[model samples]
Target: MAEKPAWLKPHGRPWTRGPGRVVFENPWIEVTEFDAVAPTGRPAHYGLVGFKNHAIAVLPIHDDGCVTLVGQNRLPFADYSWEIPEGGGPLAVDPLDGARRELAEETGLEADHWREVLQAQLSNSVTDELAFGFIATGLRQAAGGHQMDATEDLAIARPPFREALRAALDGHLKDVLTLAMLLRAYHMAREGALPAALARAMLG
Candidate 1:
């Protein structure tokens, strides 16, 4: 059985949500305002952002340990963002399948091996955006080419895994999904969970 820290346990009282009304909604997200009771026994109003699809991220690591990344301009942040391949999976679909499609779409790559490395609740306080991150090894170019959205303008990069991880740690690559996936992949490499040769390539 897997072990967990003794100190690990849920803390504090749970918030009780009462009636809620949808404040805004679109194909991608819905905002709802709710009547709620805080953990501290206080009544409060809470606003929640609900996502209609699961977020999926893929770290496509080549045999040489180069991690494929995609760059695009983001309107919300008003900046160019470089990140691993990411996309939304329908709630009813397997997230790993979504990750594979995203990898092919954004980077025109596919993998012979896939491992689910991370699961995250993007923002528990405000959003219920669940994300799944994967490490895709044994990479190769997809013969079908990419299938990006018509509106997407993306730049691709093949950077050493260590360098990409460093940029994420140094705050240069600001995508949270990319950062989280890279950190998890690093841990996997160091902990011997990954193939030794591949791990060596990643770490060195």
Candidate 2:
């Protein structure tokens, strides 16, 4: 086996993992509780929620600098949420495909261009949920309208990208993936990573 990179090498003593078991499990997630000996020689108990699928989010931007958003009642919070088109992709499946499906299902939109923008862990301390985000441009409405899940009652909106950014900054859009993707889009626009005209329109 190849030697590990310097950064990957352990700097000091590592935590010692003790006994662990699954406390609860469902189609989407599994909860595990474990005991551990910390590097500082302290004993700790931890509970972690492990996700079965990768989270995927897509920001669909039209030529007019408008973006699609979806609003739905989220079960965990028991409140209505406004977020970019998002869903879960099985860990074995390609996340980009999931992003495309979610965009179409939630907003009836498709894009000619796609770029992977972000990958991250959601709530690292509590869950092992991983997320992937993408930016999709050159968008057009699909011939058929949205085909949402039976449990979904989604509201769709097409607002200028600037407006959406403002909403996110003002805390109206609270979804972590949505906020992160929007901020990344803004960074790309300002950094000239996006098309000049589109960036100008988005920042306006």
Candidate 3:
């Protein structure tokens, strides 16, 4: 088991007074306090926000050693670019299901094998979202086809690992979460710790 860090402790009771947000809106995790004192004896809040959301990302490596990616227009970025298929939020069950669903919905591919690689809380001090990074292998093309939201226009692409990494580093691929997962996957593949197909994908 992983050891807990020294700063770990059960959350103290919320400091806010009375019930909030329940009467007028959907139920959400409320963060009463986001600022904290660090070892440097300085205060940092990292621009605290009230809630955390959960999301997932999929890196599909094919038999021919090419990583599956998507090029799409992002309203935030205001451009067409490359990124791994990812999304899921406010679900009723474990987020892994959402991860799998997003992969199939966005990329038209299914994996016979999937593993949870990491659980990351983005902007931990503020926001209330946990992003789960998953490693998927043994990919097979889907028959039912992709089911992306109409507003989300996506074109699938298969790029060799080096090329993909280069694109990521060069700003062609702009999603921070996708870049993080791919580089971590690359390191795992390099160490012979990832699926054989993933390794092959990186090489070819």
Best by TM-score: 1
* Rank by lDDT (best first): 1, 2, 3
Question: lDDT tens string, model 1, 4-112?
Answer: 8889987999999999999999999999999999999999999999999999999999889889999999999899999999989999999989999999999999899
Q: Which ten-residue region of model 2 has the weakest summed lDDT?
A: 9-18
Give the per-residue lDDT of model 2 (tens digit) for 121-188: 99997899999999999888877768998998999898999999899999999999999999999999
CA-only RMSD, every prediction? 1.2, 3.3, 4.9
Candidate 1 residue-wise lDDT at 135: 92
Candidate 1, which segments miss by more than 4 Å at Cα? 1-4
| TM, every model | 0.96, 0.91, 0.75
Model 2 regions lying over 4 Å from their true place: 1-12
Better of 1 and 3 by lDDT: 1
Q: Candidate 3 lDDT, tens digit per residue, 9-119? A: 666443332333321222445435335555555664433344434777877776666788888877865777688888865545677787778888998888988887767
Say what the RMSD of model 3 is.
4.9
What lDDT, from 0 to 1, does candidate 1 have? 0.94
lDDT (C-alpha, whole model) for all candidates: 0.94, 0.91, 0.73
